[model samples]
Target chain A: AQSVTQPDIHITVSEGASLELRCNYSYGATPYLFWYVQSPGQGLQLLLKYFSGDTLVQGIKGFEAEFKRSQSSFNLRKPSVHWSDAAEYFCAVRFSGTYKYIFGTGTRLKVLA
Target chain B: SQTIHQWPATLVQPVGSPLSLECTVEGTSNPNLYWYRQAAGRGLQLLFYSVGIGQISSEVPQNLSASRPQDRQFILSSKKLLLSDSGFYLCAWSPTSGHQETQYFGPGTRLLVL
Candidate 1:
């Protein structure tokens, strides 16, 4: 079964500092990956997605993720953090042509001002 | 652009009460619809998905059920609510056949079971 794992349960970063959130997937073949962010009491917003080509994918709000197949990881990164960036992040994986997506447990990001 | 909408931004219901959550998609047709639950501080748990009318696929067996009576409307219902059902319920739609396509999410409905 395809599944996703986010190692970090929570992370705290200072404003303007760089940020990185880790995500790992267990799948036999290449998988479609996505990153979503959710603010308090709000629905998830898609940050970015990786379907094919370009190991390094850019997303909204200055976020980017690199898909490292060998490592089974797609880690999200941002050059600088903002207070509004404090939210929950989720990593999702879906097999090609499949109808289902498996999501990680999520990582809570806290940005300090 | 396609947009998804879910109603009753927040709902409070007692255990054993019935539930009815509505989801609709606009500016799109023959889209795949999905219902997901997010526990506090946790990942999303896909509850059900529909590819077309009368075609419901359940990802997780729970106290909830879903139906697509119209091409653009999807509904999630439950005969009896449970405390475990309290969470953030999200409605999503995708242009392609299924999860292989990038999904667009609704604002979501927050349900609290007392």
Candidate 2:
């Protein structure tokens, strides 16, 4: 079974500071990884995805993630944080031939002004 | 461009009451539809998915059921609602063919079962 784990439950960062959210997955093979963000009372928006090719994938809103196969980790990073960037982040994993995606518990990001 | 829509934006229902939630997709055909629930402070739990009309696949055995009568429409229903069912219900769609594996989400429907 493919499962994703987000170690941080909540993270607080000051405006203009860098941010990193950790995500680890347990899968038999290299799975399709994705990062999504959800605002309060809103649906999730895709931030980035990694299917193949480069380990580092850039996404919307200046977000980027690096897939590390050896460590089974796909961590999201942003060079600078803004107050509007506060939201819940989730990591999802899907197998090559499957449609079902397994999501992590999520990490709540709080950006301070 | 594909878009997914779920309604009503918010719902309040009593326990033991019947439930119905609708989801529809536009600008796409033969897409895969999915129903997911997010409990308070929890991640998404996929309830059901469909690759085509009348082909519903359940990911979890629960009090809810899903049906796809049309290629673009999906519905979630329950004979009797439970308190545990009170959560944010989301609808998503993805291309069954092609190289697009990303699922686009709807605005979602928030259900509160009293």
Candidate 3:
């Protein structure tokens, strides 16, 4: 039973401000973690992913995430968010034995002017 | 380069009507295909997945079924549509031989059940 939880349902941040979205997962072993972003009425796009080794992972669109094993958390952070960054973010996990992905409830991001 | 395509960007069907959503992948072979449903303002829910042709694994039991007629073709069908089935349906594919796999999603099909 692997699952991911995103504590924030919605987050509003001003343009040029730092953004951090929280994500926690419950898995027995070292999990494969991913962060995806989806615009309204569009498919999801990969933001970043963590398999092993480095605790921090960088991805496209200037997005990054840190995998904290002790806290069971993989939070996404951006130094400066633009208006185009406003979208829904999802955290996903997958185990070694399966190909299916377990996704978090998702966090809606709103960029304020 | 690999790409995924799903047809009928948006669909509206009545209850008890049948469903047929097609998904195709290009520039890849023997990909692991998946069907996912997402409700408004919710996360993605895995409905089914396939490793090869004629092989389908269902993650959740519902009024939905999936089929892989070809190595790169996946289809989601239903004998009778349900209101709960109205949502955004996404088709995704990933490499079959990877430890840390990342799925690539199609443009997605929005379904509305009346």
Question: For model 1 chain A, where is the 10-residue window of minimal lDDT?
Answer: A93-102
Q: Kindly indicate the candidate among 1 and 3 with the higher lDDT.
A: 3
Best-to-worst order by TM-score is 2, 3, 1
**Per-residue lDDT of candidate 3, residues B1-114 (tens digit):** 999999999999999999999999999889999999999877898999999999999988889999999999999999999999999999999998768678889999999999
Model 2 deviation from the true structure expressed as Cα RMSD, one decimal place? 0.9
Model 1, residue A81: displacement in angstroms? 1.0
Per-candidate TM vs. native? 0.96, 0.98, 0.97
TM-score computed on alpha carbons, candidate 2: 0.98
Q: Whose lDDT is greatest here?
A: 2
| Candidate 3 TM-score over all chains jointly | 0.97
- Tens-digit lDDT string for candidate 2 (A1-113): 67899999999999999999999999655598999999999999999999899999999999999999999999999999989999999999887778888899999999999
Residues A65-84, candidate 1, lDDT per residue (tens digit)? 99999899999999999999
- Encode model 3's per-residue lDDT on A1-34: one tens digit a residue: 6788999999999999999999999966668899
Which parts of model 2 have CA positions greater than 4 angstroms off? none
lDDT of candidate 2 at residue A12, scale 0 to 100: 99
Write down the lDDT of every candidate, Cα atoms only.
Answer: 0.92, 0.94, 0.93
